[model samples]
Target: MSFCNPIPIRLKEARKKAKLSQKALGVRIGVDESSASPRMNQYEKGKHTPDIGTLKALADELSVPLSYFFCEDDISAELAVNLNKLSLSDKQKVLEITARLIDESKKG
Candidate 1:
């Protein structure tokens, strides 16, 4: 079955988390200031999808990884944000811990 698109929701969440207005985010990503709000609103509403390059710019401006936009679930999305803040070594540690947790869950 096909799944609903999650990019719109993720974009809105990241924008709000960054404490930015749609107009402000649009301007930061190089949209015309006058049309910024409407353009950003369209993206958030799923009326328009940005190209890959534009999506990358948005992800950078929002301080999230490009993969964050593709996350399929809220929990994974939130985890992505937190994971992005960790050092490489710390990230590896988290991966190890999560792997063990998964294995334990499978055994239970």
Candidate 2:
């Protein structure tokens, strides 16, 4: 019901879409798997909030942009639709080219 609630809901949605349990996601982000479940539960229930670093780590682990959590619009659905518009082969080619360009840019 509050603005803060959307962040956890979006995180839960992203984690589920990625087929990751809280423990698995926590592990990916270097948190203890044992504690992750309850922590995520708190997050979802809005009993606790994650700091910026944890949110960033969660976004990275979920392979989503941090903006995915903050955007008031349905950016994830839009991204999904855009990705669906791309052919699988074209997607791979684009990723490869983009990676090379990023690497070159980093070197410059």
Best by TM-score: 1
Model 2 misplaced regions, further than 4 Å: 1-4, 75-108
Name the candidate that leads on lDDT.
1
In model 1, where do residues sit more than 4 Å from their true spots? Answer: none
Name the lDDT of candidate 2.
0.77
Alpha carbon lDDT of each predicted model:
0.96, 0.77
Displacement of residue 51 (Cα, Å) in model 1 is 1.3
Which lDDT tens digits does candidate 2 get at residues 1-108? 755457777788888989988778877888787897888878766788889899989977777767666655576545643554678998898789979999999999
* Candidate 1 local lDDT, 45-84, one digit each (tens): 9999999999999999999988899999999998988999
Worst 10 residues of 2 by lDDT: 76-85
Cα displacement (Å) at residue 84, model 2: 14
